[model samples]
Target: MKKQHSRPNILVVNDDGITAPGIKNLIEAVKELGNVVVVAPDGPQSGMGHAITIGKPMRFNKVDLYEGVEMYKCSGTPVDCVKLAVNKIFKGKKPDLCVSGINHGLNNSINVIYSGTMSAAVEGAIEGIPSIGFSLDDYAEEADFSHCLKYVKSIAQQVLDNGLPQATLLNVNFPKGNGIKGIKICRQANAKWAEEFDERQDPYGRPYYWLTGVFQNNDKGEDTDVWALDHGYVSVVPVQFDLTAHHAIPLLNSWTFND
Candidate 1:
């Protein structure tokens, strides 16, 4: 018997399409948690970042994939999907929390800048809802997320139970396979991608370049997300939307541009 007076309605989403195995597994895992409503893209939108459809018309339709779960597929970016859900779809009802992704690849280090997974969660944060983004460091379509579900549910429940700081959300990454030991709450690591372009000739004889890179982690701190991930644990990074360099404000006031 399920006890339910209102178990906190949870709005689940992801950058991956509705049918992705990652989300399929996620929905099953969260069924015991609360009312799960999924609003996601109709297809993969991996590197879409935080983009939204403004100049173009967006479309969303109810989906029948998950039997008792409310699911919808949108024709816009991940951010657009959240906007539609909050403004139009679930208008009068507010979700207790929003969780994005069991993404195909890692969103650690600097990859969050280009992650559609994090963007959806960030959009929820912007709307004053507690949110979280979860990703695994594997890119295969059938990647094993067996090692991630327990940690995902634990983190989600923690966020739901304790709540989060206003204007902040979590960006979580799990190591691939079953070797993961546990979870670690850490800060974002200072790292970047060292790019390399591979030039190739297209079928029409036109030259193009494929962008590739080696991830360079310059931070050696044990408390960083990168360090935690490398140590075989799920890294929970508290992410905030405030990009202001507050410490630099005082230094900027002392600058002399007239000289």
Candidate 2:
């Protein structure tokens, strides 16, 4: 751990490229809270879950997109941006905080498995940093983020003041519009995507496919993130990177081995 500074060093990252409106709003929400440094993908990289660039040279360039902000565009995945920020920019000193997204679309429930926004936050947790990922329900480029800024600042301030539990970060999702009820601490909903691939032929008669899917939420519990978002409350779920199924481990231990 590095020496604590009077003003915390905050690292901001996202999957929606470096120029998206979501990131700008996120920067705005936290700019006054700390010294912010942004490192994000050069273009939209949504659904890129915890992906990293390997066996290829990745590009990193500093650009002055936001006035008075230190921003860099990376030609790699969102996870790569975090790695680069920690390795090259911070020089092995982890930031006081790491926040990902203000994503244009929701990353609740099963969507977190495929979200680059959440993955970036997960990467921060893996590095032993207190991190959080933020997302809005709307997917439009011009989605209004005014309602989210206040909650963003409040939650971020809380995280900064009181560090998160071990091996955990937050996955926060907000409902669209100005009628937010409140924030709720919730669990990830039981949900998944029912997928279909539309096949078509190219000009040369070669086959191609377009992935499409409908999000299906089977969990009906009111204590879930899905329920919170549906009812106009911002959902904050504590997320951890450990994939081990501890419950199953005990059952497996009880099985007889006759090999």
Candidate 3:
């Protein structure tokens, strides 16, 4: 059992900007669990999967938004926020836990690969901190996150009590509204976004394209995150930053490569 400090240092971050309602609710959920320090984008950085700022400087500013909460808004991607929190804010002294998001939309299945919310959690995992990313299925500006406060707090508390496996982080997605069945520990379903670029002319007569897609899931596993979410269960998929396909190594070993 992992014994957290009486006042654990919990770093809270999100891709939905500092002012988003999602982040506010997220802070409320876990603020009592420890010392909550927030560092997030100044504006929405959704879908910016694991991206980091390069070739340019970013602006970071401190603000007093939520009373009694230490928060900052960064002019960078979600991953950059975690990087800044781990390196600058925490001053290399790792936080006891890192929680990202209460994202405006779901990030289950293949969506995790392209989610700034989950990417922020992934960055925390990379920094050797226990992390989890939370999201809701709704995209409305006024989406209510009240129904999830209990579950969020419980999950964070559990993580505080029991640390996650090495290098593993959680990708948690909740369905919109009340009547949540329960929590389901599951795997990421084999899924993808069938994307296309819709082209149109701007007011200045310049052609631009908008990226859009339909989520495709063919995996029939009942234990997958998609199935859990579709059934009103909060899906918790343990994810890792290691992209190694160790199982394929043996198959590739049979093939000889010319040096």
Q: What is the TM-score of each candidate against the true structure?
A: 0.94, 0.96, 0.97
For model 3, give the 10-residue run with minimal summed lDDT. 1-10
Error of 1 at 221 (Å): 1.0
Q: Estimate, for each residue in 44-116, the C-alpha lDDT of model 2 and write its tens digit.
A: 9999999999989999999999889999999999999999999989998888899999999999999998999
Q: After superposition, how far is residue 30 of candidate 3 from its true place, in Å?
A: 0.6
Tens digit per residue, CA lDDT, model 3, 1-259: 4778678999999998999999999999999999999999999999899899997999998899999999999999999999999888999999989998899999999899889999999999999999999999999879999998999999999999898999999999999899999999999999998999999999999999999988899999999999999999999999998999999999999998897
lDDT of 2: 0.94
Name the better of 1 and 3 by lDDT: 3
In terms of TM-score, which candidate is strongest?
Answer: 3
Best to worst by lDDT, what's the order? Answer: 2, 3, 1
Tally clashes: model 3: 0
Candidate 3 or 2, higher lDDT: 2
Deviation from native of the Cα of residue 113 in model 2, angstroms: 0.8
Off by over 4 Å in 2: 1-5, 257-259
